[model samples]
Target: MIEVEHLSKRYGSAPAIKDVTFSVEKGEILGFLGPNGAGKTTTMRILTGYLPATSGTARIAGFDVHEDSMAVRKHIGYLPETPPLYPDMTVEGFLHFVARIKGVAAGDRANRVQSAIQRCNLQERRQTLIRKLSKGFRQRVGIAQAIVHDPPAIILDEPTVGLDPRQIIEVRNLIKSLAGEHTIILSTHILPEVSMTCNRVAIINRGEVVATNTPEELLQQLTEGTGYELEVEGNIVNLTTYLQRLAGVRGVEQLSNQYLPEHRHKLRISLEPGQDLGRNIAAIVVKSGLGLYEMRRVQASLEDVFLELTTEEKPIDAEKTIHTEPAVDSASPASDSVVEAAQTTPTTSPTLVPESTHPSGGEDA
Candidate 1:
């Protein structure tokens, strides 16, 4: 299990993350969903004990990340945005090296390395050199090294940054498969990753946690319920006025008629939460002498929820009061310094620092 409370981080005078709070239950995959420069990586680094928070605390498997950094490191596995690898080492050799550095006993090193190789599906390439492998396989090698020590918790920051669609799906499936056995915190800007892979999501914006809940619960709580789209043929001058007056109807808009036939109009109806007016709408259209040609339901999507929460300036009234703050450009020097410090930190001791913390030295996702 993982717990974070009021975890704040700052670089000089500017704040990177403020009052951030969330938790992950055992065997659950939590998606830390946010845009670039939203302090996702900052939080991940602090939780992994690679960086210390300005205030508050983080605990993994009941050990404090700051006060008990060594114990926390032993209990969790970490993968930075770029996979840290030895270009000359074979896949099996690399995992074995990582296992030994992670304190795996000499007797258990072989079994742990094999298990990591099998779980990451790198059998054929086990003997291949890391530099010779494709980017996708290299990513699998990254994950294999993370699990090689058999830690109870794993932290991944942007695991599928540059992979193609097929590779992304493969990596996604691999992360999903590790859910029950290991608690995971997947940090990503990709929307589909959260809805498809995580059981719960925490949406962060402007250095603050905006909302936290399951995908379905957040959609239902923050958005207007389902609506309808209809195509009708009639003399419909006051159709919108009538529809707007109907109970449970929130609003109605006439769509573009550019492609529609003459005298045929397309309309979209917005509905209040928990309201179903399909039967009433049909009956009213018939009574009004309009020939209803088509009617279809439109459900709210995760994209809709994400846009609404991030783009708005006012707080949304819901189970979790949406937090709002002045927008801070993610590319500012303040944020860059924190990232630079994490990347440039020494890795003299593998147990104290994750393997090759800044292998690629690329910008944060």
Candidate 2:
């Protein structure tokens, strides 16, 4: 359970994120998405207590992140974009070290470490040094450490940044498995990750939350209605003129060249929302003596929603299922300063974060 209200952060006069707001229910995995310099990292930093917000409030498991920093840290497991790892330490050794630092009790450390290893599929590699492991294994090691102390909420930023396809799927499945037991806020630029892994999505652009809704709802909301793509042969001019006159047909655009005799001509027919123009279009093409090669509906996708929102100068009409959160200022011009700074700056090394809730770090393995 997490809630952020009217969150804003400013680097000097330039705003990194402004009036951003969203919530995640218990057992829900929320995907935080945005383009480069869209205040994603800034927002995450504020939530983690690594950086403070200029204004607004963030609470984790009912504890205020700003007012009760230490208590809030106790309930959250954080993995920055770069995982904090000691290269020389063995897998089991590193997890044991992290468990202790995260305040796992001495008696419970062994079980906690073992569970993390098993959950992250690090059982066989437990004896391998982190330096010797591949990037994928190293990422698994990073995730293992986050859950080692068994925190209720986990914050993972770019958990699968550079892994191969197989490894990506493995890590995706692993994150999915943690859903019911943990409340996760996954921040990544990868759209597929959000579509496949998250329960809901929050699309932030220019330091503001432009859209917040389920992936399905966002897709339908932002979709430019529906239409059909057709591959037809023979007299294209007559077919185009005929289809354009059909009821419910909004427009028609030719997608392929008609000059080539060997290839069939491709035409995209646009239709109003909720219109089924396939049956009527087919009859017209056949009646006019043109051979219809192929026809299929063009469904809306998440990538469509993402590009439209991020690229637009003004926020999309709020009436769409995906409305911009009212708290954020929608009229302000998007700031590119944050994006430029992130690109020019070098990334810092990762650190193993230890919470202060427990009496002390666990004993050494």
Q: Pick the TM-score winner.
A: 1
The lDDT, on a scale of 0 to 1, for candidate 1 is 0.81
- Residue by residue across 185-286, what tens digits does model 2's lDDT show? 999889899999999999999889999999988876676736787888775665565566566678777664545456477777767766665656676676
At residue 111, candidate 1 shows an lDDT of: 99
lDDT, candidate 1, 133-172, per-residue tens: 9999999999998899999999999999899999999999
User: TM-score for all predictions?
Assistant: 0.83, 0.82
Report how far residue 344 has shifted in candidate 1, in Å.
70
TM-score of candidate 2 on Cα atoms, chains taken together: 0.82
- Model 1's TM-score against the true structure: 0.83
